[model samples]
Target: MLNKVYFSALLFLSLTLNAQTSPCKAAHIGKFQVDSGESGITVIERNKKTQTEINEKMGYKARYDIVWIDDCHYELRNRTVIKGKSWEGSSPTDILKAEILKVVNGKVFLRLGSNFSDEVMECEMIKIKS
Candidate 1:
């Protein structure tokens, strides 16, 4: 009886561990929204190799090529502006680095930075669609 109980507990533990998947993997293909302060909401849709963002209030829409450095680290490159003007003085060749800090509830927190500057921005994106 003791051996059976031990085996059952081991099985339960294994199942629990397997159920807890890494957040980065789940985030790869999802629709997320980030509040862009006064500019309104930025809706982002990401796939395996691309990310697209649209901010209607800002009249901005762009698509980026995604390069995954690791599980939690990735870079966005080759931005193609589809609508509105690009940021002043910003180049299309600039790379944006992002690190997944954590996912709480339905929100994903990130450490966002750029290859061209030392500035790092922290923001959270709410999962809209998985």
Candidate 2:
């Protein structure tokens, strides 16, 4: 009957639309909330606390801009902080490079290097609610 034909066409259309995947989708892109940590057993515990962190090279969490380059390629923007401190002997802003890294759980994860190299940073980042 015509009713059966109509139902089949509708089902096909639904499946086809759902099959298309885009990287720009919300499930694909999200704001990354990052936390910096230090090495050694003693320093590891302090890293978990947002205020009690011991790493000076890379400060605490910041909102990261994320862009999906491709299915496997992703990028992260420079760190951004709140209104710069106007206190005496204090720098207003800290500018960093756009560290292009890998994406996991809709976030950009970076692993630090052994010493001063980018090869040692081993931390996971998660998407932040804007």
Say which candidate scores most in lDDT: 1
Candidate 1: stretches off by over 4 Å = 1-20
When summed lDDT is taken over every stretch of 10 residues in candidate 1, the lowest stretch is 20-29
User: Per-residue lDDT for 126 in model 1?
Assistant: 94
Q: What is the TM-score of each candidate against the true structure?
A: 0.83, 0.28
What would the per-residue lDDT of candidate 2 be over residues 1-130, giving only the tens digit for each residue?
Answer: 9999999999999999879764334224333444533432211111111211123343432333444455433343333343332225423242222333565555645443321224433455555532
What's model 2's TM-score? 0.28
Model 2 Cα shift for residue 35 (angstroms) = 2.1
Q: After superposition, how far is residue 96 of candidate 1 from its true place, in Å?
A: 0.4
Residue-wise lDDT of candidate 1 within 1-130, one digit each (tens)?
A: 9999999999999999889877777667889999979989999999999999999999999999999998788999999999999999999999999999988888888999998999999999999998
Instruction: Give RMSD to native, each candidate.
Output: 3.7, 10.4
The local lDDT score (0 to 100) that residue 102 gets in candidate 2 is 60
lDDT of 2: 0.39
C-alpha displacement of 87 in model 2, angstroms?
Answer: 24
